[model samples]
Target: MDLFDRLQEQIGTVRLPLFAVTVTAAAQVNTPLIAILHWHGFRRATPLVLPGVEIPSRAVPGSAIQLDAPWHSFETVDAMLLDAAWQSGAWDVERVEQRGCNVIGASAAETLACRQAFGDYGEDMVRDPQLLGDETDRDGLMQLAARRGYVRWLFRPVKGGLWRTLDEPDDTLEVDGGRQPPCPVSPVPRRPGGSGRTVYRLGKVHRILLPR
Candidate 1:
C-alpha cells in the first residue's frame, strides 16, 4: 500500500479535534512549513507571530511564528504534513523540530499521534537525505511562495531591516509616474558623420531614437 494508505490503516479510527502545529528554530531560517501545510490542503486560520526572540544571528534576525490549523485528525494531518515536507525538499530531520497540540485543550491521542508521526517521519527523512534540496534554493522558493500567497509572510525583520512585499514601491519609480530611464544616452553632437540622433545600446543591439 502507499504511504497515505498505510498511515491511515495504522492510525485506525482515532480522530482528534483542531490543533496547532508549531515549529521552532534557533535562528531566523527559512523553511517550507507553510507551503507544505498548504500542499496538504490545510489552512492556516490563525498565525501567531513572535518577534524579537532570543535567537542570535549576525546576518538576519527575526522571530518564530506558530501556525495553527484545525485538522480533523492527527494521523491524517501528520501524514500530509510529512508527505508535503518530503516532496517540497524542506524536511530536515536534524535542525528542525515540530509539535502538535489540541487547540482548545490537551488530548492524549492527539499528542501521541504527533510524537509518533514526528519520530517515524524524522527517521525516514534521515535515511533519505536526498529529500532536501540546496538551502539557498529552498529559501528562494519559500520567498516566492509567500509572494504568491501560497504561504503567509512570517519573517519581516531580516538582515536588511524589513522584507519588502511585492506591492511595495521600488526606488526607481518616481511619484509622478516618470523617472530617468535605466538606459544612458549621449546627445548626438553635430559632426561630419553624425545623423543628429541619440544613440543607445540595449544588450548588443544599437538603436537610435528621437530625443523626447
Candidate 2:
C-alpha cells in the first residue's frame, strides 16, 4: 500500500476545510512529511511553512504544498473538532480555537523555490538551476518532478458531511462534453464494506497547466 492507502487508514473518511488541512500539516512536521501546493491563479507561489522543500504562500502569509517528493505522506495529521458544526461557513475563531485545534508544535517553512525556479506556469519546472536549468524546458520538469516524486492530494470540503479525500486528481479525467482524456486516473481499491470512500491515483500528465 502507498501513502494514500495508509493515510485513509490513519484518518478515516473525514472531510475538512482547506484551512484545517493546512493546520494539520503544520502540526505534523516530521513523520508523514507533506509538501503543500498553494495555488494562485496562473501564478504559482510557495505555501505556508512546513519543512522539506519550503515555500511561502502569496495568498496567505503561510501556505505550501509539496507532492513532489517520496517521503511525503499523511500520517501525523490527527484530528480537531469544530466548536459548532459549520453553518453557512460563518463562525467565531476565538470560540473555535478555544474549543479545539491541536497545537502546532512546529511550523512549516516559507518557500518560493517551487515558483522561483520554475516559471509561474512551471514551463521550466527545473529544480537544479546549476545542472539542468537550461535543459529544463526540453528535459521536461514533469519528469524531474517525478524523479523528485509527487502525490495528488484531493479533497472536497464537505461531501455528504464527510470530507472527501482522494489519492488522484479527477478533474481532467472527466468529460463535460467530449470523451474522457487519454490518461485516466488509476483508482485505489476500497476496503471491505467501504462506502463513499474511493481514491483515484494520478496518471501521467504532460503539462503543468496554470493553476486557478
Candidate 3:
C-alpha cells in the first residue's frame, strides 16, 4: 500500500495527537520573520519535552520547520503564534492556522502514526543526523519517536501576482527589474465530477512578528 493509504489505516486505528501549524505571509519575508519570532520564544515556549531530542536554537533561517512536536496540540501552537505576534508587534502577519486529528497509541505506534501522517516533511527532519542531535540511530527507528510538527510560511509581494488565469506564465521578474527567466509550472489534473475549472491551493496566509 502507498504511504497515504497506510496513513489512513494507522490514523483510523491509533489514538494519538497529530498536529500541524501553517503560516502564510503576503510577501516572501517569512523566513527572517520566523527566525525573529523563534528568537523571542515563539519556538522555545512549548512545554512539549522530547527526552533526548535537541530543538534547534533557531529555525533554519530560510527554510520552514516542519512537524516536530507530537506532544503539542493545534490549539496550543495557534495560541503561541498569536501571542508572539501580539507581543512582537508583528502586524505584517496575515493569518495562522493549525490543524490536527486525535490518534491514540503506544509510544512506538504513536511515532509511526505521526511519521506516516507527516510524510516527507517528517522524513526530511528525521533523516538529518545533525538535526537528530545526540539521539542514536537504531536503524532509523529514532525518527519514529520524533515529533511530526512543522511551521510553513508563504509570502507574495504582489497582491494578485498568484491569481493569474490558468494559461498565464507562472514566473515572476527579479526585484532588480531585470528580465528574469521564467520558471516552469506543473499542470495538475482537474478534480473529478466538479466543474472543469483549474484549482489553486495557496494554503493559508498569516501575519508574523519580527524582532526590531
Full-model lDDT for every candidate: 0.26, 0.25, 0.27
Task: Report the C-alpha lDDT of model 1 over 5-74, residue by residue, as the tens digit.
Answer: 3222322322211112222211122333321111111222235445864433221111122223334332
lDDT of 3 by residue, 56-170 (tens): 5433211223222232333333343433332222212233211211224335544443333222235455543212112222223223223222232222211112121122222
Q: Which pairs clash in the backbone of model 1?
A: none
lDDT of 3 at 45: 29
TM-score of 1: 0.18
Between prediction 1 and prediction 2, the one with superior TM-score is: 2
For lDDT, the strongest prediction is 3
The 10-residue segment with the lowest total lDDT in model 2: 92-101
Provide the TM-score for each candidate, comma-separated: 0.18, 0.20, 0.20
In the range 134-194, model 2's lDDT, one tens digit per residue, is: 2223124323432332222233222121222332332322221112222232224323321
Q: Give candidate 1 misplaced runs (Cα > 4 Å).
A: 1-59, 90-212
After best superposition, candidate 3 residue 167: deviation in angstroms?
40
What RMSD value applies to candidate 1? 24.3
Cα error, candidate 3, residue 21 (Å): 13
